[model samples]
Target: MSETAMNAARMIDMLPDSDQHLAYELIKKLVLAWDPDFTKLTPEEAKLLNEAENDEFVDAEDIDWSQIGA
Candidate 1:
């Protein structure tokens, strides 16, 4: 994989499962804004790309998973 693709994979692994969908949405928006020529990504890859794209530098403990169920 290219460095960009590898980095994206790592980012996806770091996200909480609950945030995966949101992550994918964010990635798609970014890809659309930045490069329309970006290859079409599978839903799974899109989710991972999104997570990586939006990943904020923070401790995982900062989020409250209990509140996510609402």
Candidate 2:
């Protein structure tokens, strides 16, 4: 990350936990405004997502949903 971005993150980290969400929302808006089509993921995010894609799991159709509300 760029020095300015790192600095911004450090500043955000110093905020109280209750205010951190506000900081996050502001950053998200700015990022979206700068690139509305943004969909790129970080290398670590991509790696984790790729691993999840290959994980074994049950199919949705096989789930016993009737037991959920009971």
Candidate 3:
């Protein structure tokens, strides 16, 4: 890892639990905004990509567990 990344990780680690969570969320937003990969896609590909992203519809607590131990 780069020194800059290491420094950032250290700073993140020093945050209190709630602040750490907020920092993580801020980082996620930054990463999404920093990439332009989606902008280069053809229109049709973009539509399909968006549909697949939307298709990941599971909620954390709503998962089916009927076959978990089978």
Candidate 4:
């Protein structure tokens, strides 16, 4: 991430929970303005996706969904 973006994120983290939504909305608007398609992934999301790629694959037929929360 750029230094400016890191600073912006730090400032947002300092805001109260209620005000965080405002910050998020502002950033979201800016992102949409730049890329109307909304095809971009935030750095954090990309990191999570990279991590998930290294995880073991699970087969749908090998598991039962009903047993998940039982």
Candidate 5:
């Protein structure tokens, strides 16, 4: 893996379950916003992200949406 990929993996691994899911989603959004090729992710990274999406520890409802005011 490239240094960036290895760093991202290590950072993700260090996060709590909730934070890991949040980071995965944030990274996914950033990738989409930048319109990068999705295939840039290695299979292992993709698998880790997919697993994060299925994790139940992160509660969307628990987030303080008011802080993101329009």
Candidate 6:
């Protein structure tokens, strides 16, 4: 383990049970954000992203916000 990781683990070990659980949760969230799985896009997803990039967007005032529950 890296020095920083070792130090963090030592600090976490000193925490109370409740704090340890909280630390674990925060660590898990950080680890997940460190690697997102977005290598492949479904056809429908690809189409939406493509349209967003290439299409003319609706004007903010023209959108019926309630219709989309926004």
Residue-pair clashes per prediction, in order, are 0, 0, 0, 0, 0, 0
lDDT of 1 by residue, 1-70 (tens): 6789789878887999868778888888988987788777877899999999899776779988789878
lDDT by residue for model 4 (1-70), tens = 8899899999999999989999999999999899899777888889999999989989899999989989
Give the TM-scores of the predictions, in the order they appear: 0.39, 0.52, 0.49, 0.53, 0.48, 0.50
Error of 5 at 13 (Å): 0.4
Candidate scoring better on lDDT of 1 and 6: 6
Which ten residues in a row are the worst by lDDT in model 1? 34-43
TM-score of 3: 0.49
Report the lDDT tens digits of candidate 2 across residue range 1-70: 7788899999999999979999999889998987688777767779989999999979989989998788
RMSD of each: 18.4, 6.6, 11.7, 6.1, 15.9, 12.0
lDDT of 5 by residue, 9-54 (tens): 9999999999999999998899887766655666788899999988
- What TM-score quantifies how close candidate 1 is to the native fold? 0.39
Q: List the residue pairs that clash in candidate 5.
A: none
Q: What would the per-residue lDDT of candidate 3 be over residues 1-70, giving only the tens digit for each residue?
A: 5678799999999999999999999987887787645356656778989999989677767866886787
In candidate 4 the C-alpha lDDT for residue 20 amounts to 91
lDDT of 5 at 30: 92
Candidate 5 overall lDDT versus native: 0.87
Q: Per-residue lDDT for 2 in model 5?
A: 77
Of 4 and 5, the candidate ranking higher by TM-score: 4
Residue 3 C-alpha lDDT in model 3: 79
Q: Give the CA lDDT, 0 to 100, for residue 50 in model 3.
A: 96
Local distance difference test scores for all models: 0.83, 0.88, 0.82, 0.91, 0.87, 0.85
The residue-by-residue lDDT of candidate 6 on 10-66, one tens digit each, is: 999999999999999999887668755645665677898998989887789997888
Stretches off by above 4 angstroms in model 1 are 35-70
